[model samples]
Every structure is written in structure tokens, then in C-alpha cells.
Target: MKSDDVAKKLRRLQGQIAGIIKMYDEDRSCLEIIQQVAAARSALSSVGRDILTGEACKCASVKPGEDFDKILKSLLELT
Candidate 1:
């Protein structure tokens, strides 16, 4: 996905996080809070995967001799 798409996902996640906080403040049920927290975590994981996929694609397009070891290391660190 493109950066704009990632940004949009991040914004949505931000809203979800805020909502979770609101739920907590309002004394929502444990199950309800847990569900929202799980959803947010899934969304964040998706975003991270998207970013890594994009970076991998970019790296693949580079010339064979290019030094991608550092980039690969950084990407691995993210996981």
C-alpha cells in the first residue's frame, strides 16, 4: 500500500485507540474493551506488514549489487 493509505489506516487506528480509552473511562465491560484492544492490535499489525511489504518491494527493484543488508536488518528489527 502507498504512504497515503498507510496514513489513513494510522488515523483510523488513532481514533480506535481514543475510543478504547473512552470505553475504559466509561466503565465498559471487560469483553467489550478486550475486543476493541484486539482490533486495534490487528490493525497496527496490518499496517506494519504493509510497510514492510512496500519496503521489500522497493529493495527488490534495486540493482543486485546495492547494499540492502542494512535495510533488511532494519526491516527485521521491526518484526
Candidate 2:
């Protein structure tokens, strides 16, 4: 996906983060905050996966994969 598309998806994630902060300020339940934290982590992982997938596709199509090492590093970091 394009940077624009990623930014659009992240807008919702931004809201999620803000909500989590608000919940903390409100003295929300520990369990509830933990659940929100997990959800936010999952969302961030999903975004990283999407970006990696796009990069991998590009690397595959180009053949020889001059940037394969970079892409592989990103995948390892995400995992």
C-alpha cells in the first residue's frame, strides 16, 4: 500500500491509542486497559505486516532481490 493508505489506517490506530490514554486517566480497570493495550499492539503488528507484504511483493517482482536483506531484516524485526 501507498504511504497515504498506511497513514489512513493509522488514523484509526491513533484514536485507539488516544482512547487507551483516556482510559488510563479515568482510572479504568487494569484488565480493561490491558485488553486495549493488546488490541493496539495487534493493530500495530498488522500495519507492519502489511508494509512488509508490499515490500516483499516488490522485491519478488524485481528478481535478484538487491534489497532482499533489508526486507528480511524488517520481517525479522516484526516477528
In the range 16-79, model 2's lDDT, one tens digit per residue, is 9999999999999999999999999998888877787777777675554658667666675864
lDDT of 1 by residue, 1-79 (tens): 7999999999999999999999999999999999999999989988997888677867686753446756665675776
lDDT of each: 0.86, 0.83
Candidate 1 deviant stretches above 4 angstroms = 61-79
**Structure candidate 2, residue pairs in collision:** none
- Compare the candidates by lDDT and give the number of the best one: 1
Q: Model 1, 30: alpha-carbon shift in Å?
A: 0.6
Please state every model's RMSD to the true fold in angstroms.
4.0, 3.8
Error of 1 at 71 (Å): 12
